[model samples]
Target: MGRLCKLHIQNDFKEFYTPQVTEGGVVCITRCDARHKTPLRCVYGSCSMTRAGPECECSDRAAFWYQDQVCRSRISKVGVAVGVPVAILVLVTIVFAIVLLRSQRQKEEYRNNLRSRSELYDSDDGNWDAPQGFAVGNPAATWEDMETPSTSYINLERVDTSRNIHIRRPTVVR
Candidate 1:
């Protein structure tokens, strides 16, 4: 029976072998073949048999990933779809904030310049009186006095209708 079992084990059951027989009976040692294994089905991927056991070879297509021995995870796709727009929005917001801060700084600098100019023009007597044309609050104080150019009328020559009349030249030489 042992010889018949050994022949059967070698020729028929390539994946199984009876290593030792104890009081319990025959000890069958099973080789790992992922395709025949019932527990490691690898539903979404192909199975590869290794010394450590069966390993799943997941698909390499985009937006897919292997997790828990399966390749059906969509977290990568969902994360990308939601993350890109959020990233762009954050970048635009940062740019807008920078632009707003720069404009505000420029305005403050302009105001400081105006204050300095006013201080420079202030009288030493502490009176509100400024130079005649140097008043800071007056809108027209900076206008230069100048005379407007006079408008001139042009005279046009009148055309005579008699000068436009066509006259026939003498056909015969005088």
Candidate 2:
């Protein structure tokens, strides 16, 4: 009995012998070897302890514990290890989606701008439907006339009392 008492005191002095009542409960801790198939039997009152179990599991053991099933330190560590990376990946995916959406919107805006500019360049007369180099009205003006580049004139001036407002007149000289 002296040996058992000495062993228990040596193993659980800090948790059981200590007078600081951390939590009210009978906490059992044991170090049982699976190969030996040793049963954990506390001859004295319970206290917190660490040890190997009947299975391949080794962790802190408790009995009549008020809290939920004690998740071992290793399990909590593994959870943290996996959870952090998964959260980061989710955040990255969200950011990538936002960037992709923004780029698509910018591309659509650019396409619309190009379409508006093309419409502006389209001639209002029936000649717009005619093929390139087709002379209208005057047959004397041949393809050579169409090839000639023309100067463009633009007039810009403030239209409103506010500096924000302006008017522009664009004339294509061809």
Measured by TM-score, the strongest candidate is 1
Candidate 2: tens digits of C-alpha lDDT, residues 11-31: 534232222122663323333
Per-residue error for 37 in candidate 2, Å, reads: 32
lDDT of 1 by residue, 1-174 (tens): 345346655454533443445588654444333323344555666766554555666765475655666555535766778999999999999999999999999999999999988876464322233333222232323335533223322222333334555789869867
CA deviation > 4 Å runs, candidate 2: 1-75, 122-146, 149-174
- CA lDDT, candidate 1, residue 141: 34
On lDDT, the leading prediction is 1
Model 2 worst lDDT window (10 residues)? 64-73
Scored by CA lDDT, what does every candidate get? 0.55, 0.44
Clashing pairs for predicted structure model 2, backbone only? 27-47
Count of residue pairs whose backbone atoms collide, per candidate? 0, 1
